[model samples]
Target: MSLLDSWTRDLHEAEDGTIRPTYRKGTGPGVIVIHELPGLTPAVIDFADEVVEAGFTVVLPHFFGHPEARSNPGTLTGALVQVCTSSEFTKLATGVTAPLADWLRSLARTLHAELGGPGVGALGMCFTGGFALATMVDESVAAAVVAQPSVPFAIGKKRAADLNLSPADTDAVVARAAAGCQVLGLRYRKDRATGTRFDTLRELLGDNFVGVEFEGKGHATLTEHRQQEAVDRVLEFFEEKLKG
Candidate 1:
């Protein structure tokens, strides 16, 4: 519930005029933190701070374009009601993650060259969970940790990230797993929105997947009541897998 005093935070703009706010702290390895559907909120910021405390450089790249949004009923109604009602919303949702995937890949390389390398690790949740994995394809990512990845459950809103990845793409990630790179993910036992996405990932990863199924826990509660536990486990996982 507290922001790490030592962390450095700023908003960076891409060449495309997209503004991305990122928070970073600590030294040694790097870990990119991607948020849920709600975008950059206090909760996601908390997650970033905790990752810094865990002893890695935590970069939370704000890709939502809409700054610091919350998904409370009223706020979501105001922002999304118009878009959702529009003809483009459905199609937009399906392919929204593609540009983001590209952004992360580019950022990963930038983090390596500009911030210095050994590459980086990742942590993504809800809508953006699979993004870490997508970034790994760029070779600048050494590890990934995803939780409750949603959009790709049936069909990724973005055409490129479509839930239906081709065999070649799937093989590349599988090879990454085999190559000593590590990827982990989590889910609640009761999250209906995520549906069976976690299940599919589990089967795909087999022994390589660091799967943690919360007991009696739903999606929201996974990061809510057990924030410290989640942070600790994820940090340890990154340190072990990525640092190794």
Candidate 2:
């Protein structure tokens, strides 16, 4: 089915310069979905539609500036912007996931206040896997799903696997996961961008983290291959932890 046909909706979200074009739908409870670095594409919106179908209200925030990005797949996105002109990419690539951290927290808080104060779930992928975990610093967020998460700029270097999270922030989030919050991650075994990231989360979150590893797939699998399965599993993870 076409993405438009799949995610039937009348959107209620408005635009913000600080945030990429966003869309919200569904009713009862809340879940915030952050797009990957290339911005909110058709496949990404389709993910949101599926999550909304699962029953939680979904908000898909455009992480990169592809503000009007289409929902269909196979568009080539520029991963790195010239640091001199594009500060957002610079901030993200340099490990300053602070903007992301703050946005998720704020969005969660607002949803709780306006939407009966029920717990909120968060999902971030690739350039944003760590986002859901870090947002737990707020405590109001009940669950998170991190898919194909990687430290910033891992795509740039061929060698040297880095966690991409600030040492202090990673430590803090680890403590949250240890205490009570549930964190889940998904990745293909061969995707190097997320390999180091998954390794780091394993060290920090230990058994508290649930990882869904695909056998032969890689980075695109999360957004492409078996997407129905991906959305279902993530929704289950959220419901398991967030629902009363």
Candidate 3:
């Protein structure tokens, strides 16, 4: 396996008939780190390890691609094709929530209940980024980070502006925002793939949405193009929200 860490691996079954392999490590409060579409590459695993090292139990669910696949253009393209063909994802649809988010929220609740903390932390990158927002409706997610959330692929203006959330989910998230549940978002200012979803987040959550925009074109805020500031902010966010 490309991931050479002491992680416990098991299968998780969702109520919606979805079963996925889960890799877990570390201890303390629970943090769910949902990987990008190219599958859980070494960089993704490394990011999860950082979260683990920051004094939190990290759960990484293999929602797509080979868990240990090496990152390359071909592998990334293959994973992209898989994501585009999957019915569970809303690859080209605007204003539609991906069906897999429900399963993720359920997983978060399970982890939080098991670990016993103020709540759980969720960090989603790439295609799964906005899933963190959807997970917030459950109230068990105390810290949510949306890093370079590129969904519906940002193929058009509307998709660019879409939050990949259903109307009900949007309302729930907005309510949480109003209730003081802060959502952290990070993306490059010129990353077209992210579109204007950050703008949408700003509009929806107002000041509750913390948008961290870096200059130039960059994605994978917590991974490949790792930003130390972003990493520190995420750890601080988890500490502030989940460690109490």
Candidate 4:
């Protein structure tokens, strides 16, 4: 059987009546794991499995692509184009939060209610990386991780600096950070795709933003060019923030 077949899948309905399929497993405080640009590939599933094994119920929303699909040039290009043209994502805009984040927040709320914990954890990678930060505006989100956030396509200086969040959302996140909710960030120092977003996060969240910067040009911190140190840091952050 395929690995995807082993996970439980359910359709989640948002407040707007839109429904999306979510793959979930494990037990404990909820953790919503958002996939990167090329969809929920095998690497993503493996990472989610790690989160599940760490003693938390994990929900992976299928925003795009086939589950368990292998990452390749063709699949990557197709997924990129789909997201770049979709209205749910702000592919080339700065200072604007994507509309899909609301749906994700709704999902988080539902999961948190079901799991009945202090709060929920969220990890967003690559194209969907900043989505985790945007979702943190909700009080239900306790642990938020942004890995290689490359939204707005990192087109220029402004795009690189933008947090992909609106002024109100940004203020809420900033206030939450000030209120003792720490945000975790992971990225490679030489990855141009990440741009200056990490720097902006540091400035916005100050010491509340714990950033783990790896050396060289690695973009996929949790998968692909997997980093053991980053994996350990992520699990530790979730445990400290969610399992406490």
Q: How close is candidate 2 to the true structure, as a TM-score?
A: 0.79
Clashes of 4: 0
Instruction: Give the winner by lDDT: 1 or 4.
Output: 4
Q: Return the TM-score for each candidate structure.
A: 0.77, 0.79, 0.96, 0.98
Candidate 4 per-residue lDDT, tens place, 1-244, comes to 7887768999999999989999989988899999996899999999999999999899999998777788899889999888877899988888899999899999989888887777899899999999999999998899999999999778889998888999999999999999978999999999999999999999989999999999999899999979999999999999999988
- In model 2, which range of ten residues has the least summed lDDT? 6-15
Q: For model 2, how does the per-residue alpha-carbon lDDT over 41-142 read when each residue is reduced to its tens digit?
A: 677776777777777888776555454455343333454342224543323344455454665677777777677553788887776676777677777788
| Candidate topping lDDT | 4
The CA lDDT at 171 in model 1 is 74
Candidate 2 Cα RMSD after full superposition onto the native fold (Å): 4.2
Which lDDT values do the candidates have, in the order given?
0.64, 0.66, 0.88, 0.91
Clashes per prediction?
6, 2, 0, 0
Ranking by TM-score: 4, 3, 2, 1
The residue-by-residue lDDT of candidate 3 on 1-244, one tens digit each, is: 3474589998888788788889999999999999996889889988889888989999998877887777789888999888888898888787778888888888988898898877899888988998999888888898899999998788879988998898989999999889978999999899989999998999988899999998979887888888889899899999999886
**How far does residue 128 in candidate 2 sit from its true spot (Å)?**
2.0
**What range of 10 consecutive residues in model 4 has the weakest lDDT sum?**
110-119
The pairs that clash in candidate 4 are none
